[model samples]
Target: MGFAERFPRWTSAVLAIIQLALTAVIIGLEIKSIFIDLAHGTIWVGFWASLIFIKTLVMMLFITCCCRGRCCATYVLAWNIFSGILACVTIYFDRTFINDPCKCYLGDKLCCAVRSVDSFRTNYTSILDQCGQAIANNDKTALQWCSTGSPPYDKVQYLKAQLGCAVGMLISCALYVVIYIFACLGICFGHD
Candidate 1:
């Protein structure tokens, strides 16, 4: 017997669980990004994240249902196709969104503005000092998580999270591809 014949139930459960975990991580990262964006008065970033988060939540439900019953083969195939398309679109848009420079400031004083050619999106923020003054712009000032000895709130962390989400999405796409292939095979062979 082939892999599918030996352990069909086990395979379905494992794939569902893995996809669920990846989606959960994607959700957590997006939530963090939302909080960060809200703190900075940026709406679009959080809005996109919210959309993706909701979609992932729906995917989680489908996967859960798939794990519980035999009525899920067709649904799973459709969900996988939708997820793959969404993931591709998300990755493309994320690349476009993060390609701008972020202007970091504390009030009217420009604390630090990223160089105009950074490879990430704009995450304009204001980090105030204890005196309610903005930190001076310097080579060490970073917006996300930075190794440049910059203050907290470096935009690098946000960019990294976006990349992580894209990776998870790609993995999910691959999983769905495998699932749909088997689903088609089952249908053609009259196994279902």
Candidate 2:
């Protein structure tokens, strides 16, 4: 059986849709930062936007891989593994440390200011108090983790390089071409 026979064409279409949808959900996670954290400064806004765009492009890469099939399937798997690790790091930091703020995946991977409070969206009094503590106290421990180099936070960047980021990016670029070719020529190339 060929690639399509090994996996039904419908499977690819379904997976592409599912992956794209999940990517949207991941992007939504950043919305909290956009409204609440990014507004705190233009610097933060620029940072987060860049990370968001990067993630969006990665999703687009995965979708293209599904559509073309076989080629770069290994690379797609590796890309996803790296992505999952980052997601885990995000969850760990969000739950445990105040300094290890949730990193934006797509656009900039920039740090969103972390106040020692809970709810991201709301007029909670705790948020202001946390901000006051962050500002007035000049907590060095908090500051240390606040940098992207801190625990859990540094893991995402570390994995990307080890995975041969340049080769992965090249695969992404190839997938983009495959997508464009099909868009213009209609599966003629993808089939054989």
Alpha carbon lDDT of each predicted model: 0.47, 0.40
Tens digit per residue, CA lDDT, model 2, 27-120: 4544433343432211232223325435545554554555445554444445444544544444443333233334333222113234322345
By TM-score, the best candidate is 1
Clashes of 2: 12
Residue 4, model 2, lDDT: 33
Question: Which digits, one per residue and each the tens of the lDDT, describe model 1 over residues 70-145?
Answer: 3454455565666656666656554543553232323323223322222125433323331133234432324332
- In model 2, the runs with Cα more than 4 Å from the true position are 38-69, 97-192
Against the true structure, what is each candidate's TM-score? 0.51, 0.38
Displacement of the residue 96 alpha carbon in candidate 1, Å = 2.1
Q: How accurate is candidate 1 locally (lDDT)?
A: 0.47
| Candidate 1 ranges with C-alpha deviation above 4 Å | 1-7, 39-71, 101-153, 186-192
Error of 2 at 14 (Å): 2.3
